[model samples]
Target: MTLHRFAFPTAIHFGAGARKGVADHLRQAGCRRPLIVTDRALAALPVLAEFRSHLDGLEVAVFDGVFGNPTASQVMAGAQAFKQHRADSLIGFGGGAALDVAKVVGVMAVHEGHVLEYVWDHPQVRPIVHPLPHFVALPTTAGTGSEVGRSSVVSEDDTHVKRIVFSPQLLARAVFADPELTLGLPPAVTAATGMDALTHNVESYLSPAYHPLCDGIALEGTRIAARSLRTAVAEPGDLAARGDMLMASMMGAIAFQKDLGAVHACAHALGAVCDLHHGLANALMIDTVLAWNFEAVPHKFDELAHVCGLAGGGQAFVPWLRQLKADIGISGGLAQRGVRREQLPRLVELALADICHQTNPRPCTAADFERFFEAAL
Candidate 1:
């Protein structure tokens, strides 16, 4: 086994009411005026009211323009808001989309060029400019672990392509993982996002990487999702289950730095073109992708099956996964979720372009991607 260096920079605070520490963390980071980036749905939540009251005497502006699958224009607009308010820091205050946009805003605030110019497209790219003010992430959902991740997903409005902006410096300086904030997630969102977390764990575990640490983390993360996701979805206010899912979500992100595979590649393409829920798209493709790749690395799936506590070795995983999905009320394939067969050609092309495809256990061509889509559909 080759030696690998692991370094995660974000300082994380986890537990119930962990969000209460945000103000103190901001002060410790020397952020007087911070821009809170969130979406309309989260902006109206009463949980944010406490943060607002905490900042009553301080300078804090809220930018609620962030939308699902954030766009480059939204990041530019957020940058403008950051500058206009003379904000000294950023607080990502919602789910993946909000956190991703906040991270991009932090990048663009210090960089001069158009936001898309900085996006690393698989090959080489210029180094990021000076890091923006300290970023504090407070997740209101238990998925997308964007708070601790270095890459931000943004959509190009014209092409409608979801592009990833990669930079180690984009990770939040501090993160608040308060499961209490996730108690209000709708059942559908809960099931979909939790499945997204499960995909991250399973795919990372299957990725052809040399990081045993990530493999172990992914295994445990998968276990947590399997055990807790359904409970969290069924009983939204169950703090213990919610906390487990939140930790699993963060673990999935950390583990996937080793790599993600066909599931994410398919989801990214479907999300860009069809505007389907990213997590749901991933959930639909995961089993099919797993079936395709299981033969390539049967031992890994065997291990995953063991961790998920199944009796059969590798083959048990898919049935367990399907059962989990059904238990959580995640029923339906990509076609049922609005993905069309006619769009397969374009979707296949876009899925090929996704960087995640490179890490798949089984290397896939455009034709392979088409087959995967057809199977999922």
Candidate 2:
């Protein structure tokens, strides 16, 4: 075992009407002109208008270049927008992709080189010597919890390989998590994002890391998601259920500081090769990978089953996940969800290369990854 470090460092203004505080939060931080970094679809929605309505005393500009999976080019484009408007701060306003681009826009704006130079794996990665712009997040969805996350995941323009820009400084200065913002989500989006949250909790808890604090948070996060996801999807107007999902999403993001496991590795590979939505990718691969992983840590599965209120403990966990996915209209394997059988070699290679699987409770090999993809296919 190795020494571990634990830190939970985000100021959260949660619950209904939390979005109303963004203007004041910025003012207190001495920011006036702030760039609203968001996806084009979200930028056109009434949610963005309503959110903007609350910022009565500030000069606001919208940079709606973000779309699909976040990419290094999007970050550069957003940084250009930030400079053109001479924005003093940033407001990440949308789901994970938008928020991820927003998190790094300032990094690109102030840094000397290309955005890829900041990726953690870059051999000559530049240090974040200058202070990043004052940035805050307003999550409009109950997934990814990018609002409270400390890293920005941006994919390459050509290869589509996801590169992680990780640093404590990348964390949002504050997070405004208002469940009302998620009330407009369609049933499918709600289900996929909810599963993303659940996968974060489950995979983190299954990691072979030694963070008891994260383990406790992960279990409780799993419990919250288990009890609330169905309600959230079935009754989109149920604010309480929406709020529970939001809390669980943030808790999952926070808990994954302990690290994630093989599910994420598979999901990341799918995202790169198939361009699948990150949440949906996680949803598709979770059951298959976990079923295989069950043999490695049956006791952990027992703990998971107990938290989810399953009767058969470890024996019941994977089956419960499968049922849950079907209940929420996410019934499918990788093939059904658009992953081609021919992409197996690339997916397996990418999965094996992904850093997330290195911490899996069960050690995995190239053959295991090939088997995981084949089984799911």
Candidate 3:
């Protein structure tokens, strides 16, 4: 029998058209004026109007200033927009970046100071001990599961240093996970994002932690991804496959309360230093990290192989990961993605500084990251 110490606090309603009830849920949360925080690209889509249709009397405000790898400035602007609209709640509607900004925006709206003040880092700041606006997360994509996460990743605009602001206060009051919205995603985006979910599942499982509860969820999440991610990529119209991936993505977020590993460390650094897509960076780096990680936790690889439905244990995992990426049309190393060779040093520096990687199965020194980058290169 398996058990869990953590319970996902967000009320979840999962189905094909679950997003249609967002307004009712907001009302249940006692929110009147709601701000929908999303990205500019999504704001232009017809879906935006449909999302607002259900909120007829809510006096909805649209703040579409979210950006890729959400910047600190974007969070500030969103907070300003929320206050300007006198919004009572927030609807995080889009991909990971949009959801992350919404979480931070919810925090900033009621806080006394700067958005950066709450970051989970040194020059230590006060913990977020206050209540936040009621928030509803509606993910348009199947990856990033940011809708269910309790933290937001924001970057310093110029330096591109990623910082996480964590608080149970940031968790959405409700999550409307509707895979129907992902039916029109481009194949490449689907593939990349699916890999991000896989990385999350795998890393959380492998992270050196004692949470058997989280370990169980991580393994199950991987199984879900293994069964459905490729199908979702090949047949974007397959709602069932999309739903599985979305569930796996959300499970990854929940399970990763156990924390992530080196793949994320590398991906975050790559995103900050190279401005790469979060999913794509994780996709490209996963195999390299896995290969390095296998020796340290060989038994975990066996467990992963069984859960991921691979025929062979241990020895087969890394190769399968590479093959899976290739099958999804993701090939080559970091160099292929226009990441200059000279950037490796900077990426390593960023990776070492990333707090998220601290729980990696094997303690990673800066040298380990350099070698990891070299392998990817």
Candidate with best TM-score: 2
Model 1 lDDT tens row, 1-377: 56678877778999987887888778877788999999977898797787677665569899999877789999999999999999999999999999999998988888887788878873555568685788989888887888889999999998889888888898888888999889889999999889988899889999998888899899999999889998998999899999999999999999999989989999999989899888999888888889889889999999999988899799999988888888988887887888888999999999998889899999999889988999888
- lDDT of candidate 1 vs native? 0.88
Tens digit of per-residue lDDT, candidate 3, span 1-377: 65545666678999999998987777876889999999999999988888788787688889999867899999999999999999999999999999999999988888878778788784868677678888999998877899999989999888988888988888888899999888878999999989988888899999887787778889999999998988998888999999999999998988898999989999999998889999999999998888888989999999999987788788898998888888888999889888887998899899998877899888899999999988888
Please list all clashing residue pairs in model 1, or write none if there are none: none
Per-residue lDDT for 259-316 in model 2, tens only?
Answer: 9999999999999999999899999989989999999999999999999999988989
RMSD of each: 1.5, 1.0, 2.0
Which 10 consecutive residues of model 1 have the lowest summed lDDT? 122-131
Per-model CA lDDT versus the true structure:
0.88, 0.94, 0.89
Kindly report which residue stretches of model 2 are placed more than 4 angstroms away from their true locations once superposed.
1-3
Tell me the RMSD of model 3 versus the true structure: 2.0
Our tally of clashes for model 3 stands at 0
TM-score of each: 0.97, 0.99, 0.97
TM-score of candidate 1 against the unseen true structure:
0.97
lDDT of 1 at 70: 89
> Residue 90 CA error for candidate 2 (Å)?
0.3
